[model samples]
Each structure stands twice: as structure tokens, then as C-alpha cells.
Target: MTPKLVAGIEPPYYTAVFTSIRPDAPEGYAETASRMRRSVEEIPGYLGHESARTPGGIGITVAYFRDLESLDAWRLHTAHQEAKAYGREHWYDSYSVHIGRVERSYGHERA
Candidate 1:
């Protein structure tokens, strides 16, 4: 599916990602991205997410969900948190997170 980012007037959600993985990681980058992508698909509120590797750093992603409750549930999930910890301790040199809500959204997909 080709997902497009539509304009939104909503509260707006914010996500901050910072990372510095060792050179060896770029070699296994596809595997790591696949793992993270699968993990996201398992979460309840999980709308979508992505990850990318670059010469300088890694790109992380997150997506919009139904509500804060769904978001919170994903947040508290044990495996999710474990993956986060793994990122902090081994995968990433540093990172950050900023959570919020969207105030509005406008767009539609035609099938």
C-alpha cells in the first residue's frame, strides 16, 4: 500500500529520533529494520512505522493511531519496551521521544 501523509489540523503528534549505531550495524540494517517493522505491526494502535540507515545515523519512525489509550498500550508493552532498551544500550548512541496528539486531519483514499 502506498500511504500518503495528508494535511492535518489536529493537535499534532511529535516524534523525535536520534541515533548513532556502530558501523557494523549498517551491515545488518535490513534485519534490524525488518524486526522493528514486524514489532510495530503487532501493536494495537500501531498505524505504521519505518526505519532507515544512513552514513551518519539511523532514521526511526512511528505512526498515528486511534487514541491515546491505544498509544499507551503500545507504550507499556513489555517487548516494545525491551526493544527500546536494546536501542538505548546497544543499537543507538542516543535517542529521544516526543508524544502528542493530532488536532485534525484531511485526506481520503479512493479505491
Candidate 2:
């Protein structure tokens, strides 16, 4: 799949970097992930996100927000909280989350 890069965002935003290694039997993971993605879009101060996964079951999703408050809102979201619990119990073998402030960002695209 082609990655959907979040464009037009300036510096000083925040990012929640979620990296996970899924188990072989990841039942219900795809549907729940899709639901979470759609739910996040409706949140206030949500900038955008980029995500990808490897055939080896290593996945990464980086979600951007306008500030710490917005990121906190996502963390406190009921659906998100539920998803996290489910992921811990069923889907993932291991996972890590890192929150960071983006001081600067640059990239290149070819036409």
C-alpha cells in the first residue's frame, strides 16, 4: 500500500509513535485498527498519521497532533483505551509507544 503522508503540518507538533510486533494469530486486529483510525480522525487537534507494517508482523503508526493536550485526549479516549487493552490481551506479542515533539521535518517526493 502507498503510505499516506500527513502534509502541510508545520514544526512544533507532537507525535505518538506506536510500534508493535503482532502475534501469528492476530484475529480481529485489522477491524479494530481500522475502527481506531477512523475514530482518531474525529478528534480535536488531530493533524494526521502515517502507518506501515512488515510481512514479519512488525508495524509502526505515527500519529500527529497539534500539542500535548491533543495527544493526551487520544490517550484518554474510551475506544482507544479499549483497543489498547484488547491488543495487550490478544493481538500483540510486544509493543512500544514513544511520544516526541517534532522540532523540524523535511522530506522529498518524486512526480
lDDT of each: 0.58, 0.90
Worst 10 residues of 2 by lDDT: 1-10
Candidate 1 yields a Cα-based lDDT of 0.58
TM-score of 2: 0.92
lDDT, candidate 2, 1-111, per-residue tens: 576578778989999999999965478877998999899998899999988789898989999999999999999999999999988988888999999999998887778
Per-prediction TM-score: 0.61, 0.92
| lDDT against true structure, model 2 | 0.90
Per model, how many backbone clashes are there?
A: 9, 0
User: In terms of TM-score, which candidate is strongest?
Assistant: 2
lDDT of 2 at 92: 86
Query: On residues 1-111, what C-alpha lDDT tens digit does candidate 1 reach at each position?
Result: 765652442444433233345444544446765776687568665565434556766554545555676677767877667777766666666566667566655676666
Best by lDDT: 2
